[model samples]
Target chain A: MKRSERLVDMTKYLMERPHTLISLPFFAQRYDAAKSSISEDLAILKHTLATNQDGILETVAGAAGGVRYIPYIGKGHAEEYLGDLASRIEDPNRILPGGFVYLSDVLSNSQDLQWIGRLIATRYAYSDIDVVMTVETKGISLAQSVARYLNVPFVTARKRSKVTEGATVSVNYISSSLDRVAKMELPTRALKKNSNVLVVDDFMKGGGTLTGMEELAREFDSTVAGICVLCEADFDKEKLVEDYLSLVKISKIDTQKRIILAEPGNFLTETDFSQL
Target chain B: MKRSERLVDMTKYLMERPHTLISLPFFAQRYDAAKSSISEDLAILKHTLATNQDGILETVAGAAGGVRYIPYIGKGHAEEYLGDLASRIEDPNRILPGGFVYLSDVLSNSQDLQWIGRLIATRYAYSDIDVVMTVETKGISLAQSVARYLNVPFVTARKRSKVTEGATVSVNYISSSLDRVAKMELPTRALKKNSNVLVVDDFMKGGGTLTGMEELAREFDSTVAGICVLCEADFDKEKLVEDYLSLVKISKIDTQKRIILAEPGNFLTETDFSQL
Candidate 1:
């Protein structure tokens, strides 16, 4: 293949498999090009990605080494996306009954999920997240997107037990939204022992669900690498979890007045984008 | 930017936004290059994608000319992937108490979902689908994956209504597994009226859930563009829905004997790859 054709295919291949290593010899064999030429093609890919601040092509040295694409968005891009997302969240029509904000529209959007997933994956690019975990229904999309960028599997925890899952391990936690104790469970074979879990969700009211996921990770003898949510209800002052990050923070929601106040959360400040 | 850098960026950009048209002038402005140069770069991308039979770079001519990246996998790739997937599903250890095969592992796998998504999107690349819909729980991931590739929004039909969703439109269908009448609902604002909906799910015994989704789509005054499931239970011998495709068909499962059988379904034979 010619250099131009190789570059196009190489970019598509690397982008599809983020955080995966591709050795120089393998690329050379695939393209029928010399190792030196493959290296030069990768240099162009690496430089273009860095110039765009959308990804990173890390080159590992030695025989077992290769190039790995990391979905890393720069600070400026992150700030701009989050700012626009927050503004979109400020729409008064989104305020629902009992102070709940209707965010299913944003959650269902593929473009929004792509940006959100890349942002979250960028935060834990080097955190060694073995698997991404989320609760049923709302959190599934968020977890799936993040897992896609991280190139890892994602498991969803369900509230009700179903016969299809075979054996499962259950956990009980306070459901602050319903003001009751709620039970959730995961399939026994869904997650492996001692795996590093990244817990994600669509919304956090009092963070009761986040705590439940943390407890479930403990039951599997796994470590909670991080906790993230797409939206956090900051008006609910009493939070059940402390160590968590949110993309957008809802500071106030007046259902009667039909007003909502939102802003980019602490995720931007908590992340270090300088590692690249 | 140089031609090499432009090719890299253009490939990444078009891949990210699949099924969306991008004009030559837009690329020209983004890369600060001439329209002719951008056309040449796209030609390289189009040729590479066609040679690989993985994607289609559709060109729309006249005054509103542009390029669209359709995530289309050829018959050969589809056959190879579904064959491997079926073989994996043949593991006897996957059989559960009631003859239900454990598929959470495959469903949670990012790599598998990526392939599955591309395959399904390839089938519906030109179907003019407005949105993807699926029943909640297991189908959420499948629906989300297809939605990502099609670059459209996806909505989940919940078995039970949640407070987060204000109002819902529900339908009743017979749950063939439990042999009881069951209800499923979708939020009123989740889907738009007159949409061309594609219903997808993880498993289909009698396709009761898929029927409910189709009925729900009808309630929204939408058309059912397609119906697809990751796995369908062929041994059941009876189905509530007929117009659907399955990636893998489970022919039999003997719990006592610890044996199971699976194969690729009608999806391969039903699709026309020559459309490209």
Candidate 2:
């Protein structure tokens, strides 16, 4: 293959397997090119990605050295996307009963998922996340997207018992949004022991569901590496969890008046964007 | 940018925005290159993708011409993956109580979702599907994966209503797996009217859930583009729906005897491989 041809395929290959190491010799052999030529192709890829501010290609030097693609986004891109996302959430039609907002369209969009996945994956690019975990229903898509970019597995915690999952460990947490005690469960075989799990959700009212996930992680002997949500109801009652990241913050929602107020969450100020 | 750099970036850009048209002038302007140079670069990408049998770069020739990256997989690749997937499903350890199979690992694995998504997308690459639809819980990830590949939105039907979704339209269907009448709902604005939807699920026994989704699609005056499932139990009672595609067929499962049988389903014979 020509150098141009090899470069195209290499970029696609590396992007598909983010955080996966691919050695120079492997690329050289696959493209039938010299090692020095493969190195040049990678140099071009790394430069292009850095210029785009969307990804990073890290090269490790050693006998076991290889290049790993880290899915990331520039601070400017993050601000723009989150700003637009917040504006979209501010639409009056989104206000629902009980101060809830209808944001399913954003969550179900392919383009939105790609952007949100890259942003979240960038936040924990170096956190050594063993798996992305979320509860069933709305959060599953978020977990899947982040897990895809992070190149890991995702496990969904279920609220109700199902026959398909063999055995599960259940935990009870206060559902602040519903103002009741709710139970969540995870399959016994879903997660491994002592694994670092990233907990994500579509929405967080008082963060009661996120706490439940943290407790469930403890039952499996897994560590809660981080917690993030797409939207946080900041105007609600006191929060149940303090250390968490949110991409969008909904400050107010008047169901009777069809009003909603939102803005970008603390994820911007919290993320370290020096890599860009 | 140089030709080599442009090829790499162009490939990544097109792959990211599958099924979306990109005019030549846009690429020429973005890369600060002549139209001829941009065309040559896309040619190299199209040829390389065709050689790999993984994707197709479709070029449109007209005043509003552009390129579209169609996610496709070769017939050989499909056969190998589905065969391996079927064999993996044959493990007796996956048999849960009441003839249920524990395949959450496959459903949640990023690599598996990628392959499954590509395979299903290849089958409906030309089906003109406007949206991918599935019920809540297990099928959400599959629907998201396929939707990502197809570059379309996905709408998930819920078994129960949630506050965040507001009003919903629901339908009742017989849950053949459990032999009970169960209700499923979708938010009022979840799907647009008269859209073409492809219904997907993680598993199908009597396909009661799929039927419910089909009914929900009809309630919105939408068309059922197709129905696909990751796995279907062939030994189960008579199927409730026809004209569906399944990747794997589980013929039998004897939990006490520790035996299970699996094989590739009709998707291979049904798909046209001439595009490769």
Candidate 3:
């Protein structure tokens, strides 16, 4: 194949399998190009990605070495996307009967998920997240998005019992909003021993669900690499979990006045984008 | 930017936002390149994608003209992937109690989801699907995957009530397994009226859940573009849904004998890849 054709195919392949190492010999074999030629093609890819400040092509040197594509975003891009996201989230129409905010529209958007996923992955590019984890229903999309960018499988804990899953490891956490004990469980085989898990969710109120996930991680003898939520209720009376990150923070929600306030959360300050 | 760098960046951009139109001027301005040069870069991309039979770069002419990337897979690739999927699904270990099959592992894998999403998107690439819909739990990932490739938002119908979504449209369907009438609902604002929806799920026994989704779609004055399931149980006595596509068909699951049988489903034969 010509160099141009090889470059296009290589770019697509690398993007599809992020964090997967494709040996130089493998690329050479697929393109029928010389090792030196493949190396040069990779250089072009790496340089082009860096210039765009979007992705990183890390090349490892050794008999088992190859290239891995790390999804990332520039500081400017992150700020721009989060600002727009916060503004959209600030709309009072999203305020629900209680203090909860309706965010299904933003959660369901593919473009928004891509941007959110890329940004989160950029923060944990080197955090050594072995697997992405989230609870069932709403948070599944967010988990899948982050997993896609990290190129890892995501496991979702369920709130109810389903016969489909053979066995499960259950955990109990206080549902702060309801002021009741809530149970969450994960399939026994879904996660591995001593795995590093990154917990994510669509919304966080009092950080109760995140606490359950953290407890579940402990049950599996796994480490919590990090915890992040798409939105957090900053005005909530008290929080159950600390040391967590949120992309957007909802400071206030007045159902009577139909007013809501949202802003980019600690994710902006907590994430180090200067390396980009 | 130079032509080589432009090709790499353009390929990534188009792949990221499939089915969305990008004006030629946007690329020209981003790269600081001439319109002719940007056009030339797209031509190379289009050709490379075609030669691989993996994607389609559709160009629209005139003032609104630009480019749209349509995710697709060749017949050979589809066959290979489905074959592998079926084989993996045939493992006796996957057979659970009461003739159920464990598929959370396969559903959670990012690479597998990518292939499955691309293949399903290929089948409905031109089906004018306005949104992708599925019930909460296992199918959320599947719905999100298809939605990602289709460049549309995906809404998950919930089986239980949550304060997060204000109003909902509910439907009742016969739960063949439980032999009861089960209810499912989607938020009223989650879907738009008169939209075309593609229904998807992770597993189908009698397809009761899919039927409920169809009814919900109807309530919204929307048409069902298509219905697809990742795995369909063929051994089940009856099926509630017809005219549907399945990526893998489970012929049998003998829990006592510790045996299972599976094969590629109608998805491969039903799809017309000749247009590519």
User: Which digits, one per residue and each the tens of the lDDT, describe model 3 over residues A7-52?
Assistant: 8899999999998889999999998989999999999999999988
Model 3 residue-pair collision total: 0
The sequence of per-residue lDDT tens digits that candidate 2 reaches over residues A37-86 is 99999999999989989899999998899899999999999999999999
Residue-level lDDT of model 1, residues B1-276, one tens digit each, is: 999999999999999999999998999999999998888888999999999989999999977989999999999999999999999999998999987889998888889999999999999999999999998888888999999999999999999989888899999998888889999999999999999999999999988888899899999999999999999999995899988999999999998989999999989899988865
For model 2, what TM-score is found for chain B? Answer: 0.99
| Candidate 2 residue B179 C-alpha distance from true site, Å | 0.8
Report how far residue B84 has shifted in candidate 2, in Å. 1.3
For model 3, name the residue pairs that clash.
none
Top candidate when judged by DockQ against the true structure = 2
Instruction: Please tell me which model should have the higher DockQ, number 2 or number 3.
Output: 2
DockQ (Cα-based) for each candidate: 0.89, 0.91, 0.90
Q: Across residues B1-276, which tens digit of lDDT does each residue of candidate 3 receive?
A: 888888899999999999999999999999999999998889888999999999999999999899999998899999999999999998898888888899998889999999999999999999999999999889988888999999998999988878889999899998888889999999999999999999999999988888999999999999999999999999897898889999999998888889999999999899989757
Which run of 10 residues does model 2 chain B get worst, by summed lDDT? B4-13
Q: Which candidate model has the greater DockQ, 1 or 3?
A: 3
Best-to-worst order by lDDT is 1, 2, 3
- Cα-based TM-score, every candidate: 0.99, 0.99, 0.99
